[model samples]
Target: MTRTAILVGITMNQVNFDYSMEELANLAEANLIEPVGVITQKIDRTNKATYVGKGKVDEIKGLADYEDVDLVIFNDELSPSQIRNLEELLEIEVMDRTRLILDIFADRAKTREAQLQVQVARLKYELPRVVGQGEGMDQQSGKGGLKNRGAGETKLEMDRRRIKQQISQLNKELDSLVAERQVQRRNVRKMKSQLCPLLAIPMLESLRL
Candidate 1:
């Protein structure tokens, strides 16, 4: 099913700002996510907390609610704190161009090698963000409102550990596959070298005649 999303970006007077936003919409389409609305901020710099100014963040929140989007897609990659802050204010699933690209790569990965590479890239990308997510949760867990804070921390720890383990395993598999390919390539080269002398014998005889 096609999901709808709001496209968000901040333009710092860059020449390629328009092109980048257009590409983001195209990426959303490629991921089966329809671009229902677009929200852009023209600023000299990004908001360190939300990647957009407070006013622009509110605007995006309104648009997300109005469009009832499944997620909001940012034109650039957002920092983990920025993502957390934006999601908190917007109250919607947030995505960035980097994650969207990774999702597309994952969807198109057909071979085991390609899949392993994608998985590793994704895990690496997620590892830091997971820490960012845990930061806020861990802080809130001490408060009276969040009683199950310990459970949440435990789960986050498990997630972090699991991601690390998966990344390590995938890397090992990739290394093994790469080594196997290297050996195969060496064998092919050796065979070609052995056949070259035989090939040259016929050429030498023809030259003599």
Candidate 2:
């Protein structure tokens, strides 16, 4: 299925801004996303809270609403807070380049090793973002303050623990794969060593003249 997306980029003295945005479009295409439009901001630096200027964000939000894009993709990596902020303002799905590339890698990963690696990378990327899951919900639960806080904390802790466990497990599996490959390489070297004498016999016979 093809999802429509809008590309957003901030040009802060970057000579290759155009190239990077083009690559971002290509990446979106690779992920089965159709880039319907591009929005760029020429700023001295990116806004910490929203990634782009407030005015630009408003324009982007209007453009996204007008175009009816499924999501908006940023050319640069965004902090968890930044993503949340943008999604709140835009009222649409928001993604950054790192997540976008990871998605592509995950989709194209066919082998077990490749899949495990991708999973590990994704877990690492998501670990920090899990800590603030219920910020809004906590604020909204004015009456059941203590209960809501406790539940949110417990859930957040559980998520962190789960992601950590998965990352550890994936690392162990990868280590085992590495060890197996090393053993196979050693066995091949041993076989080559054993065959060296036979190979020399042929050379010796050829030099009999």
Candidate 3:
């Protein structure tokens, strides 16, 4: 039999995140991810580097070990460095808020355009951190170029180059798609101009009330 692990979520929002966290754990369970624990940090704002506080992160790591958990998930977008740091410290698979939503969106994207849009958004979110990580690799590599590099190329340089190329390609594709969308939007505006209201439908409903 497979060993089960825990699901962890930390969110700064205190209002409606509780129900979402429970739902997420259920989804994880359905995927055979054992819900060992969840740690939430209800703060006014999310931390920039860690998302959660360092103190909270350490606490979660401890809980994971105590629970014998194999994974950790965050309820907010985490920088790439945040992922690297958490994975290094916890020795577990770590995923952020964006990744979870991206997984759900990818599965639900039926149209070719929808699929491409999701791909572009995911890559754009990832590219910055991939580039940022290369800075750390550069320091470790010292003066050496590709020879002292990691994997095939210098770790820092390679990730930067690859991410740059991918981002450029994705941008070109998105630009073409956006151009098509502009034409469609114009057509819709012309046809719906007579029926289009000045304000949002929700605001109109409130007025009716």
Flag regions of model 2 displaced more than 4 Å.
Answer: 131-153, 199-209
lDDT of 3 by residue, 1-209 (tens): 33355555665555778887887776665445677777766677666766677888788888888988767877556788778877877888887657767766776799767887788777777766664454644445355656654434455666767767876887788788889999999999886885566456768899999
Question: What is the TM-score of each predicted model, taking all chains together?
Answer: 0.82, 0.85, 0.60
lDDT of 1 by residue, 1-209 (tens): 99999998888889999999999999999999999999887888777998888888889888899889999999999998899888889999999999999999999999889999999999999998885354445443355336655543544677788999999999999999999999999999999999999999999999999
- Model 1 regions lying over 4 Å from their true place: 131-155, 199-209
> What is the C-alpha local distance difference test score of each model?
0.88, 0.89, 0.71
lDDT of 1 at 177: 93
Top candidate when judged by lDDT against the true structure: 2
Give the local distance difference test score of model 2: 0.89
Off by over 4 Å in 3: 1-5, 10-13, 26-34, 42-49, 53-55, 131-155, 174-209
RMSD, each candidate, Å? 5.0, 4.0, 10.4
Task: Return model 1's CA RMSD, one decimal.
Answer: 5.0
Candidate 2 — worst ten consecutive residues by lDDT sum? 134-143
Cα deviation in Å at residue 83, candidate 3? 2.3
